[model samples]
Target: MKLHTIVGVALAVLVATAGVAAATPGANAQDSNSDDAAKQGPPSELPDPVPEFVSSIHDAVSDFLDGALDGSLGDAVNDVTGSSQSPPTSADR
Candidate 1:
């Protein structure tokens, strides 16, 4: 429900802003400022996404998967066994 609301809002904003940049080549001029896109500068002052954060997330996921495997290895193996759990039928797909 929260996701739907956020997505709806985002879609609405995107729709509203659609063709806006192109409609006015002098976009900044409308706002009474520089009209150059590059001159406007990046909104985010920070650097591009840091690799350390990505590595941390990856490590966390790896630890979770490892723990899950250790705790439920049998269930995981059974999941792959066609005899135990048949492959998804067309209807399931």
Candidate 2:
């Protein structure tokens, strides 16, 4: 039961994290497309003028998010699930 639960939860996290990560670049592209369209022509139906900077920026952002997910963010999530410490009290302690 515990094994199944862990696997299930892990799968869920993997799926959700992937979904969230997927959105960042896609949303940016959509915005860029829209802006370009407004300034130029049809964005949703027609093709976009490919900017060289866009590819590099998208790659960099994807890399950063990937690193964050694999590094501190992963630690943060694990800490929440694995910690025994009491929830923080007032800072006056």
Candidate 3:
């Protein structure tokens, strides 16, 4: 057999063995006490994992995109109707 063919077969066998091992129960079993860790949630004094600023920024971006899309649609309609009016600006709101 060619060298590449032999190497390919070896790699395939190794992958198959690994897959079988991973699928087998009791292989690298977790500790029986692992459930104890979940009993306690995040530390008491710590702030929320997600900060308010992150959410505010996300809301701002979402609002901006929504406004842009609305303007684009309005512009499309105006173009189709041969109206020369400009799209409404944020100040118009």
Candidate with the greatest TM-score versus the true structure: 3
Give the top-scoring candidate (lDDT): 3
lDDT of 3: 0.69
Q: Which sections of candidate 2 miss by over 4 Å?
A: 26-93
lDDT of 3 at 62: 68
Better of 1 and 3 by lDDT: 3
Write down the worst ten-residue block by lDDT for model 2.
Answer: 69-78
| Candidate 2, position 14, lDDT | 100
- Cα deviation at 54, candidate 3, in Å, is 2.8
Tens digit of lDDT per residue, candidate 3, span 6-93? 9999999999999998889875566657986566678779775985555554554565577743445555555555669987889999
**What are the runs in model 1 whose C-alpha is more than 4 Å off?**
26-93
Q: Tens digit of lDDT per residue, candidate 1, span 21-45?
A: 5686773354545366446657767
Clashing pairs in 2: none
Give the C-alpha miss distance for residue 6 in model 3, angstroms: 0.7
- lDDT, residue 69, candidate 3: 38
